[model samples]
Target: MSILPVSSIYLIIDLISGFFELLEYTFYRRAMITGFLASIVFGIVGTYVVIKRIVFISDGIAHASFGGIGLAFFLSHYLVFSFDPLAGAAVFALISAVGIGLMSKKKVQREDTAIGIIWVLGMALGALFFTLTPGYQTSMENVLFGNIYMISDVDIYLLSILVVFVLVAVFLFYHELQAVSFDEEFAEVAGVKTTFFYLFLLVIVALSIVFLLRFVGIILVIALFTMPASIASGLSHDIKKIMLYSWILSLIFVMGGLFLSYVFDFPSGPTITLFGGIIFIAYTLARWVRV
Candidate 1:
């Protein structure tokens, strides 16, 4: 690996100072914290997602969140009840995750076929609901591409709880999770509850998608979820080490991308995801050359 020169050291100092100044603002602070929590959850969940080769299922759930967003906004108009779009997304994500999880097991249909149908249905439902929504106009940009500035105190709290939940779940069930990830039939024959574990894993994935919504939006959450894990998988065969490396890689991408967006006035979600993709490509190239 190459090292930075003295000039680069000064640049790093200046950048850190600027980032600290930005953190003085409440929204900036929340964005950074939220990004940090998101990194942790995504890293842990993403390891199983990558190793299980269920990236498509994750993608479907993320995209399906749009339906929940639209449903929340539409219901808020006439239902005399308050609805949080994020909550709606959580609900829809769980439904989609479970639905797809079960459907993929059916011998009657191909998994991709089921995923594609649900994917399009979710998008269409969202569009219909958003179009019919009255009075206030929704910002498609914010819906499709997230703005870290939109993160709130409630989001912070929810994400904090989620990170803790994920940590505990993974720690307690690490062996079972590992068993299922590598081979479901072997795990089943060994008396593991394969079906329950499979659905439970998908539920965790749903929550991860919801937690990432404010930071990356539904459109780009999958990128942040999968890319870091992809890079980590290339680097480590041990699941625990892969999770740790993925967390570190995700943090670097989230923080560096946030800084880059702040400096260049780019959309934070896509900018962060783009940075992750670039880093993965670079890492892969370096590994190939070394080999």
Candidate 2:
């Protein structure tokens, strides 16, 4: 007589599972907010990054920051300080940025070659530093793959401030950034202070990379920086539209990946990256079909 009610109990269990799923999604929503803020900055800057053929430069900075991560671990272990690895990363990355910027001015060496040298040297330093430090191996995993659950309220506040700062700066210098991004020689002729802007952009990139390392880690951070913007750029013809789509797509990936990871018991950063790759491939295929 009660057999007919079994399906109702199953449905109730399903509903409870769905409710927990929704609750779990709140974490991912926070991740999406962080990713949204990050991708917008990256999208605008990454457009210029890709346009200037400085993709390798972004990779270089991302990798070079590993030195800072290792140093941060050493400091955290020995100095009994509570310094965020991200802070150390930003400091070192800014140094690398300045170094790269200065080297770019030298006519004897190409920017790519200079960046390549810095990249290798930076990683080597990081490896050496980590090996010299005690109690680094366990924590180093977080630096490489990231732990999205570590996104604290403080991090959210910091990321919010950075997003606002970058947006305002970009707005205030829209014409200048556009000019420099499109044609540095023309921008220089037009009194855009090309060198200043170049340096400024590098610093901004460094900051962005640092903030990203917490969620995506040093190894996969560049994928977050470049992939959404690349997908959006392929889909949009206008700069504004590209940025808009990039943020939206980034939001989708972060949220979707977070949800999937929670549901499937997978790592957050890799899930997000895998989601971004799928979106990029799907978008590319769609465009190819249309063409």
**lDDT leader:** 1
**42-118: candidate 1 lDDT, tens digit per residue:** 78898888999999998898888889888998998769997998888888899999899888765466989888888
Clashing pairs in 2: none
Compared with the true structure, what per-residue lDDT tens digits does model 2 show for residues 148-266? Answer: 76677677788888888888988898778778778999999978898898888888888888877778777877776677788878777777777777777777877677667766788
Every model's Cα RMSD, please?
A: 3.4, 3.9
- For TM-score, the strongest prediction is 1
The residue pairs in collision within model 1 are none
